[model samples]
Target: MDPFEKMSLVGLRRYQAIVKAQLPIAFSHALEETTPWAEKALERLQKRENLVTEAIIKLEFGDDPDLGSQVSRSAAEE
Candidate 1:
């Protein structure tokens, strides 16, 4: 992979870690605010894995020209 792809991957990995770490606290706060709403929101949010992944990928890779090209080529090869 190119440098940009590597960098973006690193960023994505870090972002995932941060999100994972914060999720429980976020859910707890949400629950404290309201149980039923929190549960429903969490359910809907959990179902958006693909969208979340794509958004992260796009945010990480879209701005860098090198990463963008690498991603495009990789997708084409697949």
Candidate 2:
């Protein structure tokens, strides 16, 4: 076994290389083994992002909008 792997400490370059090398392998395996799970995760994330965008749009331009004014006031105070 490599000395770094045997111990808790690794050189910075070695650590970076290890991470860089493993990312593709990990992603490939994840894509192959967890297609449905990955798709569900992505869909959930997209739904969350859409909800956040809608909320932000409402805050910026709705009838009872207050966050924009609050942000501008805070910036002016600063």
Best by the lDDT measure: 1
* Model 2 quality (TM-score): 0.38
What's the lDDT for all of these models?
Answer: 0.58, 0.48
lDDT tens digits, residues 16-73, model 1?
Answer: 5655565676578677877777777666555443344554556656667677667656
TM-score of 1: 0.40
How many pairs of residues collide in each model?
0, 0
- Candidate 2 residues lying further than 4 Å off, grouped into runs, are 1-34, 63-78
Instruction: Compute the lDDT for candidate 1.
Output: 0.58
Residue 53 CA error for candidate 1 (Å)? 2.6
Residue 5 error for model 1, in Å?
A: 9.4
